[model samples]
Target: MSTKMIFINLPVEDLNRSKAFYEAVGWKVNADFTDENAACIVVDDNICLMLLTKTFFTTFSQRPIADTVAATAAAYALALASADEVDVLTDAAVAAGATEEHCPDKRAQEAEVGMHGRTFIDPDGHQWEPFYMAYQAA
Candidate 1:
């Protein structure tokens, strides 16, 4: 089977700020798909996120978009190469204006469960979780 690429689309209140936040998390924008109303954030070789302005995004859906600030329909989670990478990326996100979803102490408590992750809410109120876990072949 051929590999399928993933493209996650998110509506943003401010395109520039959204683009900056993604950049802070170490994602590069694919200029070929970027414009005033939208930006293509390259998450990895197989994953990409389309950050679209609410006005432009409305064209793709007939239903009213949820106000991210007031409600969230989904949480975008990403898996990283290592636990340290999760912290590094999450720290950068916080420095870039993202609010931490869990406190440092809570994260420590969660690590005891065998999975490690950091969650942050972006400027547009979209939730992003970066996590890491090691897998061993049986």
Candidate 2:
């Protein structure tokens, strides 16, 4: 198969804010696929994140919109180049209004699994974890 492209669709309360948040993390907006109802974010060469207004998102599914305040619909994890890079992504997310109180605890988790990561909740309550791991051959 040709190089598979990954598209992750997300529901957002405020498209403008979400757009700004992702942009703060260094991802470019894909103008060709962006409009009033949705903003397409280019995460990488083949990865795209489609941020849709909650109302617009409803048209695609029959299930009720997830109550991000009371519960989580999903957790997205991004792999970075190193432990420091993971911090850079997470720090940017926090600076852009994401919640990331899981600090030293997150650091402690790294010691147990040989991985480093941090979890942050976006303004709309979407959870994201930026991580790094070195997998050595056995």
Candidate 3:
């Protein structure tokens, strides 16, 4: 089987600032897909995030961009290798200007079930949950 790719498109008020926030979270930018109005951040070989300026984004979508800060635009839940890794990434995000857990209940994952995670809101109000699970299904 071939590996499929997932590209998440996000609208940002400030392109440069958003790009810098993702980088501070330990991902690198794919310069080939980035320019003045948009940036492609390579989260991994299969995942990428395209941060587009609001003006540029409207060209692709007819609907009004949701006010992420006021409402839930999306939740990007990431599975990491271990609990420590989850903490590291979330910590870096917070240090890079991300708001740490607006919803305190979301800060911890299913710890009783051997999962641990931390939720954070990026500078642009996108929510990200980095987690680790002890069990894996076949």
For 24-96, candidate 1 gives per-residue lDDT tens digits of: 8899999999999999999888999999999999999999988878877788888888889999998999999
TM-score, model 3 to reference? 0.92
Q: Which ten residues in a row have the lowest lDDT in candidate 1?
A: 129-138
Segments in model 3 whose C-alpha atoms lie over 4 Å from true places:
102-109, 136-138
Error of 2 at 37 (Å): 0.4
- lDDT of all predictions, in order shown? 0.88, 0.88, 0.89
Model 3 residue-pair collision total: 0
lDDT of 3 by residue, 1-138 (tens): 458999999999999999999999999999999999999999988999999999999999899999999988888999999889999999999999998875545434375567787889998899898988888521
The clash tally of candidate 1 reads 0
Which digits, one per residue and each the tens of the lDDT, describe model 2 over residues 15-131? 999999999988999999999999999998888999999999999899988888678788888888888998888889889888895779767867677788888998988888888
TM-score of each: 0.89, 0.90, 0.92
TM value for model 1: 0.89
Best-performing candidate as measured by lDDT: 3
Clash pairs, model 1 backbone: none
Which residue pairs show collisions in model 2? none
